[model samples]
Target: MLFYRAALPLSRKTLTFVAGIIRRHRASIGSCWRKLNPGQQALLVLAHLRKGETLAELAAGFGVGVTTAWRYVNETVALLAARAPKLRRAVRDAKKAGYAYVVVDGTLIPIDRVAADRPFYSGKHKKHGMNLQVIASPGGDILWVSGALPGSVHDKKAEWIWGVLAELEAAGLVTLADKGYLGSTYAKIPYRGKNKPESQKQANKAHAKLRAPAERANAQLKNWRILRKLRCCPWRAGQLAKAIHVLQIREA
Candidate 1:
């Protein structure tokens, strides 16, 4: 009843990560995602985010239509979100097993007018609408992802650190983030004991150092042409994150 499991040549890191996830959220994965073909589901999800594919493009690529492609993307995203508790637990376990020190940030995806009209964003992109806010580990594994918000919405305005920190706290892990997340309240240990200006500067320095790995991780993600382009809708972005995470874990 394995809904999704990686194929052979599984890297030690990937096998460990998957095993941890399965151990932590055995119930949810079995209950919800058991019906779907893990390979097709993973491919379909990745196709949406991969560069050079519109809904129409995806339809043609998968030999379907725009409508059907959209349906699959939505359904898959909904399924993942529904099983968020399990995913969260998996991420928590990974952190506990020395994968702590997460990198938190957000990205935007552009959408056309028809999709733009939906409530996905509070505000719209200049011409294309956007899906905002994704928090991932250094290996590109998503810790938590927020609902699609307006492109105009600033990362700071979203205040995702609190929730992300809470999850980390519950998991007993520490966090590392960029300046965008400064002043954010989460499961963080702030640096102390420097003079006023120096203290602030030192905090910034520390954050930068801690965030270095995640920055590199994001760069690696961008190296994948798929993530470079905003082909998928917001929902598909989550799926894309999952696929990338899987790939990263395997490579690791």
Candidate 2:
């Protein structure tokens, strides 16, 4: 097959940063030589995550075996994921950033069917995917991204299970979210029930105005193509999300 050149819309700083991580990881592991150097390995992983390149295509382009390509992608993803901020740290960061509030939201990262398929199916989305909880600043900056849970988990349950509510309560930050988070202990969600007083309706209108930025945050995360859908194992979804989270923070 003929090899062709391609482009990724990433800045040089992002590429250099990824290469640095690979360099340090190799030093820590005392790794031997590989089919690709740290820069090449970083490129391979970034291409896979950013462009959703297939394993066969990546392997062929990089001049390595498919297994080697897979290994590199997984290794680099784990390295980046380890750097993603945890929830508590994220909230403290928002406080330091002088933001009045943070926004909590969740999204479905669609995935291919696995052997144990039942749990990954979401009745709401009518598909198989992973649930990713994202916490963002008022300015729509991503502060944290939680590990993957099965798609079947409701948005409310997913947040609760991840201790989002408890953490926000402890932090005492004003948190904005959609109706999916209505029952949260600390987050402020829109009003429900068919018959609402004029004041509740006005409250929802104002709430929606404030929460528009959160939708942008979700779009930003999905901007990384690999997250659109996962052809890899379902278990890898969390690592993939976290990896992208780190990359996005670097990008922003």
Candidate 3:
């Protein structure tokens, strides 16, 4: 797990967003009266997700049972994830905003070592993790995030498996990507062939500059330390990623 001596705080905007979600959900499906209010429940969940606080620590700090703490965190994560936009909707908004292209990238979120299954092992990172695909606007706004896939999976395969590339093509949106997606249609990948002309070299440099936003978007997501190295079940990673993505969009 990624641990820091001093905990990070969630932004006011994020708190407001979480509060609104909790309020609506409480109205729809009321939770039993408890010591923690909606605001405290939201904060407890955020502390786990953003500050990388352990379940035991959170439970002790909040004076609740460990199981109750876990329940609050997981329930809030599900609510936030439900608000995340789909790929097609995000791309349509980008098109409406007159964006020329969207950038695509993948990230490896480290997780606790699993003994039995080797599927989560990433040869590239030399760790057990999950691969998450991100699509971002040119200005560094995250547009969509794909569900978690095994880290052994390549970025291109993840894109194809999630129908991201096909959806981008069908939407007629230009995509900017790195060499990993060289053969993907409708994506402007950097020049890779040897003995390229000066023009191609310049184009490659320009491509790198344009692709920085996607990298920044990836960094922003990982700044939430729970994602820095997940200590929980691998199956829960996707839900956490989606929840964080929604909070990010709301903050933006």
Candidate 4:
């Protein structure tokens, strides 16, 4: 089973990081006898998350039953997410760093449409998925990620629901967002008025230039292919997103 990891192409840094996390996870949980060591289990879960491998394939490759493989992956995801920072803390950090502003944006993560519920249907993207709000520094470092919301929720609504705007407001941290978050007092959004003056259009363009890094940050999150199209339970979307977020921070 360990040989399977060698066969699959992965970077040395990622392999080492996964092994370290697995070692720490095992140490925290105390001694336990299992078919695969912590490193192998970590590799198995990382392959599933980073490679988007299915349970059946992971089970065969890791020499574990499908049920065990699923448990291992979910448990590891939860573990990583537990260490993710809350929105308020992230906002405070930004203020302490003397950042003039942070960027906020909402991204849609495609998921398996297991049901016909309209909530998962995003009219904007015309797809079934969940919305995740992300905040990043001007340099494209992700500062925080909000929990999953129904795809049908508007970007502004999602920001309010996640208390992102409120936190920034309380921390006196300005934020740069797109027109999607038009009404936020703490966020500097592009002018959306119709028939705007040349000055307004120019401001919008400059606003766009500043907000470009947020879009790049969102793209970086989606680079974790498991987030490309989630096939697991929708309730776990937040956990998976947070796990990927923490891993990306480590990469930085």
Candidate 5:
């Protein structure tokens, strides 16, 4: 056996919070016994997510079989993902936060490879990945992350599929987005097709400025390391994203 040390820059509060979730989950499931306790299991999942540690290394370090480690990660991720807010709840949160408008953005979660080629290929990014739409406050705080869609889905279409614009509008909220959302009523985007008036150009500049800060929401997510590129099933990408969303919200 080989042993080594690695760092996971998460706080003890994060570990304890996750452990509580798993503890209740185990009791609910009537899980009588396990090789690792709730805290250990939480730590293992956090390591995999924050440090991007592979299942093999985690299994070796924790003295568990690879399958057990895989099961722990999946179970914890699913539990966390289930706690993530829905579109309606998210908008209501924005309302409570006294936000008149929210920033909308989309990102690709890269995958090593997939069962299909064209379906997973993002023409815009020129890569294979999953598309996740994010909603952020004006201050760049992430409020929601939509379910994963095929990378081929346009940002405009993905947001439409999530019906975020309609939800926000119904909540009396506005949306600030990029050119991809140009055709929508609420998505305020930059001007199109060159040779515009100075006023229009100035408006576009302001739009870009407003949208720039929201980009941090994407950074907040990808900083977790696991989201930088998913080594797991592409179908699980949304679950992991939602899981991260829940953790980020609670940890904040």
Candidate 6:
């Protein structure tokens, strides 16, 4: 007879860790319990998110309609937002562990044509969808993410960068960004200048002198293919932000 290995049960150490987290923020998940079978809903939502499955794909996978899948995603997003403090705490812990410098940038995600009516802009090639701005630590862990903005909006004006600066300033941390955010007074050291190659190079060098760590961090974020390709829609932009944050935390 062939023998198969059985998976081990969750250890007490892991269970206790999760229990403690839940105990501290039980209220966040309370709404979820009243709305759906929290455990099943959470597992289904996380599975689809982790797989990067589109709404249609999720619908087909779970034998549900696309609208149902969308509803699930929306609810899950709300639940997560309710617990955003936990996410912020995770970022803070990572920063406390020697990850100080931060990188700020924006990317666009493509959406379906139906969503085009909402808000977007036409670029050289494809229609730009939503813009996702992120603030990540030098180690690439996302500290906080802002909601999506219309593609036509300037990167500097995106809520992720400008709207959150006051909170970050209160925390006493410097943020770094590209020329788009040049005029931002909140950045401890803003890097901006004319478009001339020599001028750009000089500005970069000056920025490095002020904060070399943040410059290095931005270089790493741009290395990601998704960031290189601006094609995410407003809805997917939220998922992408969560996905990136989860990945960063795991990698950190």
lDDT of 3 by residue, 12-45 (tens): 8788779778878888876668777888888889
Write model 1 residue lDDT over 66-179, tens digit each, in one string. 776776666554544454534376555666658757766656555544544655443423444444455566655555545555555656665452355566557766666555
Q: Count the backbone clashes (under 3 Å) in each candidate.
A: 0, 0, 0, 0, 0, 7
Of 2 and 6, the candidate ahead on lDDT is 2
Model 1 ranges off by over 4 Å: 1-45, 55-91, 112-131, 138-141, 160-162, 170-172, 186-203, 216-252
Name the runs in model 4 displaced over 4 angstroms: 1-14
Query: For model 4, where is the 10-residue window of minimal lDDT?
Result: 1-10
Pairs clashing within candidate 2:
none
The digit string of per-residue lDDT tens for model 5 on 1-252 reads 769887788888889999999999999989999999999999999999987889999999998999999999999999999999999999998999998679999999998885567898999999999999999998888899998998999999999899989998898877898887878977778889879999999998888888888789999899888999988888888899899888887778
Candidates arranged by TM-score, highest first: 5, 2, 3, 4, 6, 1
Q: Across residues 1-252, which tens digit of lDDT does each residue of candidate 4 receive?
A: 344334444566766776777778878888587777777887888878787888899889878899989888877788889889888788888899998689999999998895577989999999989999999998888899889988999999999988888888888777888888877777888887699999999998988888886678888887778899988877678889898888777776
Looking at model 3, which ten-residue stretch has the lowest summed lDDT?
A: 1-10
Highest-lDDT candidate: 5
- Please state the error at residue 152 of candidate 3 in Å: 0.6
By the TM-score metric, which is better: model 3 or model 4? 3
C-alpha lDDT of all candidate models, in order: 0.53, 0.87, 0.85, 0.84, 0.90, 0.53
- Compute each candidate's TM-score over C-alphas: 0.55, 0.95, 0.92, 0.91, 0.96, 0.58
Worst 10 residues of 1 by lDDT: 1-10
The residue pairs that clash in candidate 5, if any, are none
The lDDT, on a scale of 0 to 1, for candidate 1 is: 0.53
Question: Using lDDT as the measure, what is the rank order of every candidate, best first?
Answer: 5, 2, 3, 4, 1, 6
Query: The CA-based lDDT of model 4 is what?
Result: 0.84
Best by TM-score: 5
Better structure of 2 and 4 per TM-score: 2
